[model samples]
Target chain A: MKPARAAWLFLAPALLVLGVFFLLPVLGALGLSFTDYDLYALADLHRLRFVALGNYWALLHRPAFWAALGHTFYFVAVGVPLSLAASLGAALLLASPLARCRAFFRTALFAPVVTTAVAMAVVWRYLFNTQYGWANHVLGAIGIHPVDWLGDPHWAMPTIILFAVWKNFGYNMIILLAGLQAIPRELYEAARLDGASAWRQFRHISLPLLGPTLLMVTILTVSGYFQLFAEPYVMTEGGPLESTTSVLYLMYEDGFKWWNLGTAAAEAFLLFLVMFAATLALLRWPRRSGA
Target chain B: MMPRLARALVNGLLLGGALVALFPLAWMLAVSCMPPGTANTLPPPLWPAHPTLDNYRQLFAHAGMWRYLGNSFLISGAITLLSLTCNLLAGYAFAKLRFAGRERLFRSLLGLLVVPAQVAMLPLFLLFKYTGLVDSYAGVVLPGAATVLGIFLVRQYAQGLPDALLEAARIDGASELRIFTTIVLPLLRPVIATLAILTFLAAWNDFMWPLIELTGQDHYTLPLGLAAMAREHTAGTESLMAGSVLTVLPVLLLFLSMQKYYLEGLLLGGVKG
Candidate 1:
């Protein structure tokens, strides 16, 4: 058989799956976003009608969309930095010469990443309960007043962010550990020989070399934080006045719960645009600063 | 060359971090073994007063967790086996084969990575509904069988295969399929294991797509069933914790056993790819 034909044969199955399931539906979403495809239309195709930008217009005017967007941004802005710091700190300790039982610590740290998010979220909800939670119990032992971790509107998002960080930081820790391990030990040796302190060596040698990996992890984490759904869905049910209602959660309610396909498709596209632009900006920011 | 005091400080901090990471999981297990209402007290118990298998028994008996567990295994196992095959072929083809428009096609697929899976989900649900695949395992499993990330991961590993090996196979009068099966598959074992574990875990833990696609209670996966159990005000905290434990343990054990390849795949997919 011809090499090209054989190659195509190898590619055909996956390509068909992607084309039919992924590519076709993405195009269908674009079409759906321009129309009024609600429960009525879902019941019968005859009720479908094109509304051309009307869904986007309505979303722009809807306060819930804006609120959900704000909540999502809040999650990304706060969660990304916190998660990155936790991951970096853990990686640094593991990479340190002073640390013992490195393998055990690494596995223990990474164990959370492998657990189901919904399951962990449920566990966390119990752990953070205002009355019976261990979090408040520890605080009480320290002579601090109990704070409503999940019951308060203002605290719900923050608690979920904490859970998100604890659940996710180890994943990035593994990647960042790889990045740290890749840097030449000779570079650190030379720096120490030059009488550079640990902080100075890290700021100079480790930071610069780990830049690309850090940027990639940041982009991935930011996009991931933006799609915050399951945590809030399980922990708070997007409640205490919907403080934890993420954009994806809103999209789920609109598309699945209410059968508002047009609005949900528009919500999804808007989110994709935002995520794309955010990652693009992250990719370009360092280049501009260096230049 | 560091002082002993500073070394102790660093190790102590690491110990603290590990505790923070493992505490909730530990608490989940402990609470799952406790009797009902034991956890709803003024101070939560760190260990079960009397460890019992009653919660697990209740989950299997009353909550129908057995069904969900079977469902999860069936769906995740099918997805892992199917997607591994799809990704292996496509990734190998892209790496070693001489094909038309290979680079362009691969680039476009990478570009599609930026679009969130949620964008396609709305329409995909409609597609599944119209095609009568909704509430079926196929609806949940098929769409996940050919992810771009999986292909990218396999392709990255496959690119390291020596071209001379493939050329020699061809010159020896071996068909492409025969060469792939005999020579390539053996070499690709590491990557195949990595991709299989990743796909299985993702499918097992997946919630959103299953929630949307599988509307019936009978078709529910573990995460979906656990979510429903948590939402209902009637379910006991002990049973819920047991459900969470049951849902998480298999993948956790899988990861612990195969962490070397899993971590290798992470760096390969995240840092390099």
Candidate 2:
């Protein structure tokens, strides 16, 4: 066979899988979104009705969809910064000259990133258990009363946020640590010669140099945080009156549990648009501000 | 004196952070070993007084954890093998082959990355149901058999291989298939290891899709099984921890052993792409 034909032969298997499974279904979801494809329609194609943009409009009016959106925003808004701060803080410490056994600490911190979310969430559920859990036990010892972490609606999302940060921060920690190592030692030495304090040196030298890495990390973390499903599903079950119900969790329920494929497709698209817009805003902000 | 104090403070903070990071996992192991109902006691014993295998025994014999473990291993192993083969072929072709639409096709693949996998999942379920694949191993494994990231990673690595090597092979009258299997496969060992571990860990830890696709208890992966168990046995803290340990231990060990390649793949996927 010619090289071109050979190449096509090589590509055929992957293309077939990706095309049939990924691309085709993505297009199908778009078509499904325009129709009322619930359980009845799922059972009988004759029951399906064409409704252009109706799914989107119906989701817009639904309280659960809006509430899930608010919760997702709440997650991204709070979880991103907190996760970044934790990651940056840990990376800074590990990068410090005085830090000992850097590899051990790095691995320990990154361990959570490798474990299954459902498994760890299960452990976390017990750790934050109301009466017998370690979290409240420690809090009670410190003269603070035991607060319900996953039980109360007001506290459930926050608890999930905490779990998410713990679960994810280490990943960015590794990336930030790599960025930290790439900074020149000479720069730090020159700053020290100029009598620049550690904090000032970090602000002027480290932060400015690490800007690109930080931006990439932020974008990746933001997108990942938006897909907040397993944590709530495993830990809170969108509990205490749907406080932890994320947009993805709502989609899973609508699409899988309730078989409301049309509305679920709309939910997925809205999430995609939101994430796309957020990523675009992040990319454009730097250029627009001339930073 | 001030430097000494600062050093101590930094060490203290690092130690504290490590403790926080590891305490939950350590506690899981501890509770898993403890006798039943011991975790619910006042003060919640940090270590088992007399560690026993009863909970683990209970997990395997009573909770049907072994079935889920077998399912997880089979599904993840199959995905890793099939995905690696498919991705390697396509990645190598995209890198070195003379083909029309290679660049355009690759760019389009990259574009598809932005459309989250969840977008395809709903319709994919209906498609699977129509094809009689829902609740089958094929349903879980086939969709994951070729990921954009897998192809991208392999292509990135394959692009680094010398063109002259392949050219020499072609001049020697070797077919592309022979060249790929004998020369390219061996050359791509490092990346193959990385991709295999990444895919295995991902498939093992995956929850949502398996939870959706594998509806029956018999077909459930470990995560799905554990989630189901968690719902039914909410108050059985010790038994739940045992289940959690079983679900997490294999992947944790795999990650720990191959962390170098695993971290390399992470940076490769994140930084370059």
Clashing pairs in 2: none
User: What value does the lDDT take at residue A200 in candidate 2?
Assistant: 93
Tell me the DockQ of each model, to 2 decimals: 0.87, 0.82
Model 2 gets an lDDT of 0.92
lDDT of 2 by residue, B89-190 (tens): 999999999887789999999899888888999998999899999999999999998988999999999999999999999999999999999999999999
Candidate 2 error regions (>4 Å):
none
> Could you tell me the TM-score of candidate 1?
0.99
The true-versus-predicted C-alpha distance at residue B36 of model 1, in Å, is 1.0
Each model's total of backbone clashes = 0, 0
Question: What's the TM-score of every candidate structure?
Answer: 0.99, 0.98
lDDT of 1 by residue, A48-68 (tens): 999999999999999999999
* Candidate 1 chain B weakest ten by summed lDDT: B264-273
